[model samples]
Target: MQKGGPPPGRSSTTRRASPRCSAGTSRLRRVCQLRGLASAVGSCSSPASKRPCRGRPESLACRRHGRSSVDGRHRGCMEPPATVGHVLALYPLDRPRAVGAFDASTRNDNLRVVDAGGRQFVLRRYRRNRDPERVRFQVRFQRHLEAYRFPSASAVEARTADPVVVDEEGFPWTLFEFVDGEHFDFSRPEQAREAGRRLAEFHDVADRFVGAATASLLEDDVRRFVATPRAVVDELRDAFGIPSLELELQNFRRRLETIAASLHPERLDALPAGWLHNDYHGRNMLFRDDAMVALLDFDKLERGPRASDIVRGVLSFARERRGSRVLRPVFARGFLAGYRERRGISAEELAAMPALAELAFAPYAAICRMLQADHQDPVAHILGDLQGMRETEAQCAALRQILV
Candidate 1:
């Protein structure tokens, strides 16, 4: 077990039921936000004590596998009052006074837990996108990271010796030792630089883990890139009648094709590859004193060329919080400079980066929103991607100039 983590064995404390709190998830969030007042919140008593805990029995948001029992589980929407019945009953931890969201963890899947003994934990639920095979694959990689002492939020196993717990709703969940840190402050070039170094270290571990399997993973990446643009266009045209769409799309489509043309499968396949933390942006990392402490949300973890992660990381680190624009050469320089401290990149990889720029700037969220077909001008959503086109071009130029 990771140090300071809850014990993995079954709890002798019998399952205690609690009444649904009127405020539900929010009240727990409110109460747990202050550690000093934890005891003031209502809590579930042991079976020996008949006091009903104050909270709703809501769905525990976890990285769910749905491979276990759904019996005696909370169904429908999250009730949250049954903190003891769900979290405590499911795991071997001591009674918790309040459950809340983790720092910067806006998703429902992750929660900050503080037990009576003052032990801290993160209850991570696979509430959405719970593919069991993918969950297992990620868990295997996390364990390998732990073996390497890499600072990621690795799941602690249950008494059953499995990290994932399928609750009554058949959702998968895991508990992790609480990591202490905050999101990277973008103003600090050193943080961006440090993140680059850490990413290099992370890539080193992934390289070993992937080993002989790198070829297949790169192939998977090619298939996705080759297919996504067509799928995006087809989905839009079929659903929204693309020709009727305004002028923005004509330019957008041309730009998309140009990006596609720049990246041929043969050339793309030839580039150097490694396991990528597909979403390595600032929001997904936590830092302390400019040093990266924990890398979070490996849901998109995949194997691909190092550039897929590198180019994206540089963009994300340098992006302006107000305008969504990158900070140009300065932030990018810090990132790559620190990256070079730990790993070596070929000039070939650097050259491909300019062509990879538009591809890296994905419009997934916009495309997904347009797919709902609610808007008369559904295809208009992609105009957002065009707004940054010139800036993206400028950044690419800046990138080419930085290494020199």
Candidate 2:
């Protein structure tokens, strides 16, 4: 929710290039070139007729004079591109704006603290997903929580009253009212307790939601990828020219399969199900002076076992000191205690937590392998996770005592 800074690895400071006041169509591509995408096209061009720059839509370029009053005029030099500035303008705002990316891992984000009229908002370009139904359900669910006054960021409709808008290259983007608070600090127990309390409130409100947003069940997800034959890893390793990694990946696969074999897939599925934020961690939560102010990022919201969400939170938010990846007892105690304050986590749910948490690596590591198609190094994230899964057995026994 912080504003006015470029994302990591980007220049923190920005100065606008010379303004383009030309009325011609050729001048339209100037915004794209300014952003450093040479292949980027302008509004006069059709993305479908030609290949888009880096597969992104040319419609992302902002119009110096918008099509409507509500769209607002984009004036002044801002750190971000014209497309982002235009998207931020989609919501009703005054002119004289400043924009930049925020600290987000999975999506494109522009955080604007104050518009010309001093209005604050966050414009987010969601990761391009093929599922429109899922996007709709997420929008509705956030509205549902906002109606109840839950402390969370809700999507604001665009100028056309549509909750979501498609860019020219066909990507979904939305605007959010700026949440004023510091992000949750994991080192603080009180902050963690507040996070736990808010999470319980979220689950309670989410239980009543009925929508068509489809999601893969966690256990089923593990089954799907863990079932991949050992040869698949070998093939991927050779294809990617990382043949040396085959032995390590093979060992991880064997360990993952063993952990997968011990899980009660049917029982995990049968355990009480409800709407989950799917991703509940410190970074996704906002806080003010130690109290949680808002929970952000509901894109992964889904129907799943409540316990799965709890363990995911623990894994994400809890401390892992001394390089041991084990859940901190203190954090676990507070979170479980807070969750129980609203609804009870049954014995079955508690018992399955450790194994379920361990088996999570199967799908996660597989996705990292998938990311290699884009030439990203998945080693940094995967190495620690695979090692943690290998070492979790001893820690699981200790964690069970504290959990139950």
Candidate 3:
């Protein structure tokens, strides 16, 4: 099986679209209203949370399998047959009452497990190409965060010496204490500030962390981040049947290239490096009211420019809040105030963020992950994440002024 993809032999089938996102094809590109209770990443969001997306046959955030399945069956999922044993053997949990596919993640398949005690947990069933070392390192890192009382999805340790449990098929699995909360709410200033404080605390704790960390995910992708979109513009436009999207994407790509060239890899390397939550954003967070309860999805944990992650987080909040991609003064101030209470982003670091943001932001690149990992039909979810942030790029100077 290819990394971040389904097994080659299993043909993909069309799944029903979530009604929350199927308002219309045109509405598919419309970002969920920040104040409203809809989500930008399909239906996997909270009243406080919003996500950015393009258009697709189905929602990006979806329940993968359950009675909600096409025919009330567990189809197209990777839940091991002996999931109960995996949990019972590895962690301290009662016998599972039921196990079901949780979210529509493409990489590590997430299964929501309910124990006989009615408590919940998420079992991260590793893919065939999954590395035990990498997962072990991530699991250990998770434990370190727990030691500091950081708001991470706590990893449940195995009874054995290893952090991970090996299934009968030899694939490794890590069980995480279930975190049930709404997605990050960008509309609330307190939540934004709270998120910033949490992130700052994360960096503070990570600095004391001692481990052989993974390579930066952005090491080779900086150039691709700028150039790939322009090169694939026409092909993607045709594939998704988005008529006028080519011009918009082309414009954004051109701007991204310019920004990336100004801030080359060497230039970015000049900034400080740290253990980054490489995928830190609203989509990977859980919240309750104004408090960020848990930070989820550490799969992309690695060392990288600290400013890049910080900029990406604020910009993502801006993007998801009613699709207004421009940075709002309130969000910037609130987040930074909270972050500053713990650790500070230097004036120089703040200055570098606008350009780094152009390189780090994912939505700007039109990520179509369904083409790679998801087993959904090509047309069904192929265009699920083509949402662009041309407005954010255009207003970088304004954003920089706000950051400063």
Candidate 4:
């Protein structure tokens, strides 16, 4: 929850490779110089060596073959071609074309590409440490949305029919279609209003979908800090130099625990259980011109309170400077309007909004700080905007009055 490097004991750097040399003659020794695996030769030195030499050799021999080499290594072991079908086979796509490629952060292992057919997809090599059940849950969530006609992207294809794909090197990979549209900008009042409305619509329908019973979007965060609230409080104390932060964190923790406890077990047990898109922030909501086109990023879909989705949307609105004021009411009105037109909100559920809003903020703030730390940059952008939120207290107060 605190802003800093990887949790203490973790190393950020990758492991270094060790080398073993074969019993040699002088030719292979000189050939070893050509091995140059550690260097930038784009090829590893033949693991086998015959003799020793000084300068790099032009004719790089293959480790497998004793002497002659063709095309730098061997014609028999030519590299495979990179093609859309290959990507589709690994991660199924309904239809695909390679449009352009871009880089994903080092944190993820995948090659990102905006397909020519106007879809964004990622080509990932397989990795072992991934959870297959989680991947299946995510894919199933997408399918559930599609089945319900919800405004979300569909996972049309995957390389491995199995939800998890482990590549030759034990790396994992999957492709997702890009949901095209700009992220909703909080600076725009109209956009914020629309985002709110769309989110409300999403939540209203999403209520009927099954979500995982044990899953809570905040589970990871809660577990991480449950036993160490003081550590987080101390981190905030260092950052903000505020005497009240410790108490504030303790109070926040109590509120979270109460909310977690108050969740109706019987109601939750009876409700449909499936998937919920856990990350439903502004960036995940795509827009075209003035209208919200699609919501992307299903990486966080899990099981929990349906209200959590609406709460997340509202919190995202609250975090936006200009949008915080106008969007929430507009979204509330629109969402309630839409939900009522379909299924109605209970009085109890309606009354829970304010508390939900309060409960949502702490996790949200912690996430922003964690992201800033992970990126190794000051969260000037987020902090400045949040400061703007503080400045708009009067406006928010007025909106709350109007909504209540």
Q: What lDDT does each candidate get?
A: 0.59, 0.58, 0.59, 0.44
Model 1: lDDT of residue 190: 88
Worst lDDT window (10 residues) for model 3? 1-10
In candidate 4, what are the lDDT values of residues 242-359, reduced to their tens digit? 4534455455455444544544334334433333465666666667777877676555565545554554565565453534434456544543454355445555554444444443
Which has the higher lDDT value, candidate number 3 or candidate number 4? 3
Write down the lDDT that model 2 would get: 0.58
Model 4 residue runs over 4 Å out of place are: 1-111, 114-120, 123-129, 167-171, 187-194, 204-275, 318-341, 363-402
**TM-score versus the correct structure, for each prediction:** 0.72, 0.74, 0.66, 0.53
Q: What root-mean-square deviation over C-alphas does model 2 reach?
A: 8.3
Model 3 agreement with the true structure over 1-404: per-residue lDDT tens digits:
00111222311323334333323312221312211202212222221333322223432233342213211113234532224343455677766532334443455666555677887877777652256777788878888988999877877777786668876555678877787677766677788888889999999999889979654222234435544545544555555545455555566557656766766556666788888887777767888788877887776787777897788777766554744676778887788788889987887788778877755543321334323333444333323323434445677877777786
lDDT, residue 183, model 3: 72
The TM-score measured for candidate 1 stands at 0.72
Q: What is the C-alpha lDDT profile of model 1 across 116-170, one tens digit per residue?
A: 6898887766644344555666777877776898888767777777777766555
Q: How far is candidate 3 from the true structure (C-alpha RMSD, Å)?
A: 12.0
Candidate 4 TM-score versus the reference: 0.53
Name the weakest run of 10 consecutive residues (lDDT summed) in model 4: 1-10
Candidate 2: regions farther than 4 A off: 2-16, 19-80, 128-133, 214-242, 320-326, 364-366, 369-375, 378-384, 391-394
